[model samples]
Target: MRRADEKDDDHVTELVSRAEQALDELIKDIEALVRLESPSSDLDALRRSADLVTEIGTRYLGVGPERIEIDGRPHLAWRLGDGPRRVIVLAHHDTVWPVGSWGDDPWSLVDGVIRGPGCFDMITGILQAMLGIRLLVEDGVDVDGLTLLVTADEEIGSPTSRALIESEAQGCTAAFVLEASGPGGALKTERKGTSNYFVNVVGRAAHAGLEPEKGVNAGVELAHQVLAINTLGDPDLGTTVTPTVLSAGTTTNTVPAKARISVDVRVRTIDEQQRVDEDFGRLHAVLPGAVLEVEGGPNRPPLQASASQDLFARAQELAAAAGLDALESIAVGGASDGNFTAGVGIPTLDGLGAVGGGAHADDEHVIVDRIPGRTALLAILIKDQLSA
Candidate 1:
């Protein structure tokens, strides 16, 4: 075992050189994953994607992941090394792009850029992790107490994998999320917690052309609720309460008797999340004869900076040791499975994924040149943790 402080520069350079040598194979693995279109909504696609991931993981790590299925969706888990301390490498295989959205040719490599569905959003991160582990094993570094969990549903908010993530994160020393990097590849130290709500209104129906006054309008009640909900946002504290989707009415001749409002809530702190939850629970219908029903609260808790500060500091040290550019950390509004781990009181660091731009957009891509250095950095981070 190599100590982190002993011959640190040589160790960093050697790992980086090994990663560079494996760059071609890394790109090949990434292409294999990108070729498979695994949209979050498609179970069949997810299954195929899981199979491909299992194969690639086995080929690289010399071991297959255990397939943990939830609600017919397959999630992959690998428990490597059997040490006293445990850490998790959290990633997801699902992409936002639907099937056929990327057209016939989903894979492309041009001008040292690889473009495809799920390439930047996190496919490369998965591959990079595998390569990092492979490098660690080849160099005789102990990877015991490491768990790599590649979940199947993330693009749609990890409906099936949240509990599993929380369970796996318990008592772990650190969680490294393989989500896409922020602008300029900054590590994500903080992420706002998210909540989803559906406000339903029920009212009596009546003829719009005749006695519209007799009708208790659900649409009117929904409008009132939307206005009320909009007031809950605190811009100074970075809390946003947005009513995104709305629906009401039965026919053109009748007053709207049923309505629904989909609310999206984001908060930077648990206090704010609790405040919003209480505010939402107090919502009431202004119109007479309208009953309101609110469902769904706090999906993922905030990934607080406290959960990542130590890991971020250590990562900076590793980067410096590797002779790489200084690492930067950012707080993003987006949430990931990292939120679940962090919420469970685990130290979590995020955005240690592919360096690229335009995630979830048509031009989603990965910078081909950054792969080796990033992979090497990840390996070094993991080795440091294992050594400790």
Candidate 2:
């Protein structure tokens, strides 16, 4: 067993070199993908993107992906190998930026950088995952089982696709999310969970000029609740309660009958999640004759450190073996499909995508030279996990 393990490691090390050699083809793959603008709300655009992915998967894996449509948006899934042990590669094709936002041309390769609406945020990672699997298959590496899931609605908080993602994650040994890396190529071992709330205040409306004294002001009540909600943030615990969107009043003059406020809650732990949930639930309308109702909580649970440490350690080892810089793990406030998998007790490693900045920004782009190394790192980790 030891001898076979050593042989597999050597093979994987060589496979890393092979991955580097395949850089040109991989870059073209990424360019092709980034050119397709698949916004979360655009079903036609997302389907077109899915078609491209299906073509690529069929060309390399000899089997196309299974398309799953949720609320008219399409998601793709490809299962490779039939071994009992399974690993999932979680990715999304939807980008936050809309089309034509990248100026005249969204797809431009300039001096070792690819800039576009979705280039760095995740198109690169999606391609890298395909390339990694291609390399593994072409090399005849022993892969137990691998599932590649590309969803279409992640950018807008994954409202429709969380069930599908969690279902696929049920028995997987590990999961890897291909979200773009942070500055300087940092991976993510922990991510804060997002608990969103829609706080609605209902109060009696009366004419401002005619019967102002009879009106119960919902807007004023919402103001007080907003202040209380803002106070829920604790910098020490990395918990924040921010009211992002507020809507009130049918007209400016009347004391608004209904006021709605959206609260964004982020927490670093499940304990914090519960605390915030309970606290938010306990909130009551301060003003007499007004009622407060809170809806929605914890869209994605935190990818706790304990659930990711082992996978992150393995990633670091593989990075070192591939002659790359030591991989660092971080805790980010933004959540991913990784949060779902980790929340379900799967060891999940995240941010294994291209090394770049400007996710969801017009300047969004990926470091061109880093693609091969990142792809190789993922290939090595997948190969190593299969060996184990």
Candidate 3:
């Protein structure tokens, strides 16, 4: 009974001690994961990433290769030990940057920073979970049940992967999403749901030099749609519509007959989604040529504050006990696979990834020195949560 009164860090130190010895293997694992070019929409890249993940899962976590397919990609799940409480450690094998989108060679650790596609948003989080699970197993700490889920469609709003995430999360006790934390490494608490919509316009075409009245410019029609979307911006409500990509011309002389604009939407609540729908619908009335077709919805379920404060309070307590300077946090708008498990009624923690910048840009890099600390933090969290 006296043991139950002890502190979480008492168990944390032992797990960290063992994990410290696995640093080299951890780096190797991260490098290998980053090397696989698994853009969520690319079939070949998804296959390669799946094979690597399955190999590791089978070799270390005691999970087999065969996975039930949901959206034509393998949603690999592995676990160790069984207890009444089941928690999912969520991450994505898919990357936002596709093959050839980065530097000449996108794989390798340069001065401790692993450079490659999918390193931050978020293959590194996946590695952290793998190593954390390994450390827990080595320490003989029996967590109720830990399910590590790596999916292939998180980068593209998870349309093909959402059903599988929900199914896997059905009876789990809690989840920890591995999305990158805040700019300064603070963890995430609440996140707004996101959507990607498309608007297409069609107009008559004629020779600009010969017949001016005979032609209608599709680009001009698309411009009207863009302006309509701009009017929906509510910065106060965290609702926004950004028309990020547009294509409208085949040649300089021709009046464009077709144009398409891709819009990215973010909403903090379900009610905001309705507002976005209403706002977007107005585009057709303003521009009759616009044959807008919206696709994708609610990428990440708004990561509502945990129903029970025990989960967040417990996490804050553990971090404090572990000697982290302070329990830092802020609500973010980004989504992660963890959102799925938590949305399905599991207590989910997030922002457990390597400290880094340039996640989806050319300058993407990880803080080399922070690897050990982040790895140590994860090891501690697992042990603290599972220790009886």
Candidate 4:
């Protein structure tokens, strides 16, 4: 006569063992996806990648996902089980690495470490979701009301898939994001919101050595605006406003008539976003003859910590039951599709993917040994959420 908690622990152990046995299959699937480079900017590569994802998903779940195409890009979705409580799993198949960026060897597994483009960023996460569902079905768990979305354009700000993601997340009990784990496999409980702006200045041009007084000097005005934008960030409050790109003057001697500045903004709260937006709107040209135009605004809202509190707690308990390392949570500065889900007032827990470093860099890789534990943790979390 085992206690309820003990029984739960045994169940988790069984699931973990199952995942361990499937490790080779998981690596094979990851290798296949890594071999096909699907950069966000490449449509043809995205199509091929989507096809491979579909094939792998169908093999695992015994069903094919509905291919949703927007702007010639393919996003895949699957609606599984049926119940009152529902959950949406958010993932993206697109990577930051372009085709041929991996050099000659696209996929490599060395000493239990797999390295390739998109392997850590998200491709492995997509397969992990599929495998988690498969594991649940094999164990005869009633996984009702589970939806998985694999978008094609998340790396490029989800230009084509934001609306669809929101729609899928509506009325869900929880949203689990598989965007890779944080440092040391920690879960991302919160993420900063992102905003982008481009400041364009126009002014009268004149010969610098001759009629300098007749020119408004847009370059000078741009400098003033950059200094003003720098004041918006409050480090204590986790707000950052950075002028990333700047361009002014066409030649060394010419009185430049045009200048542009690209600003990057991140905030931990909606109020900060509003404050920054209002301040940017109030910007005016310092030069009397110069005119300023601001473009772009708040992109993805923040993933507030409150939205993930409950889900993350459950994940920790489930991780312990699964006999894995103690779980930790982090608040990252980067934004993900989880931000959109949390923005819609749904409870979302992110960073439930692979345990690896170098997300978008040349050394991107995944630890082969940790795959089973991570997959098992996801499986148990989903099972518990659905049951609840």
Top-TM-score structure, candidate number: 1
Against the reference, the lDDT scores of all candidates come to: 0.91, 0.86, 0.71, 0.91
In angstroms, give how far residue 92 of model 4 lies from its true place: 0.4
Per-prediction TM-score to the true structure, in the order listed: 0.97, 0.95, 0.87, 0.96
User: Per-residue CA lDDT of candidate 4, range 1-388, in tens?
Assistant: 8789888888878877888898889889899989989999999999999999999999998889999999999999988855553889999999999899989778999998989999999989998888988999898888778998999999978889999999988889899999999999999999999999999999888999998999989899999999999999999999999999999999888899999999999999999999999999999999898999999999999999999999998888777765788999999999999999999999999999999989999999998888877888888888877877
For candidate 2, the TM-score is 0.95
Worst 10 residues of 2 by lDDT: 97-106
1 against 2, candidate with superior lDDT: 1
Off by over 4 Å in 3: 1-7, 70-72, 81-85, 100-105, 108-112, 287-297, 306-310, 379-388
Q: Cα lDDT of model 2 overall? A: 0.86
Lowest lDDT 10-residue stretch of candidate 4: 78-87
Full candidate order by TM-score, most accurate first = 1, 4, 2, 3
Candidate 3 per-residue lDDT over residues 348-379, each given as its tens digit: 77787767877778777776566556666776
Higher-lDDT candidate of 2 and 3:
2
- Evaluation by TM-score, superior candidate among 2 and 3: 2
Instruction: Report lDDT (Cα) of residue 335, candidate 2.
Output: 95
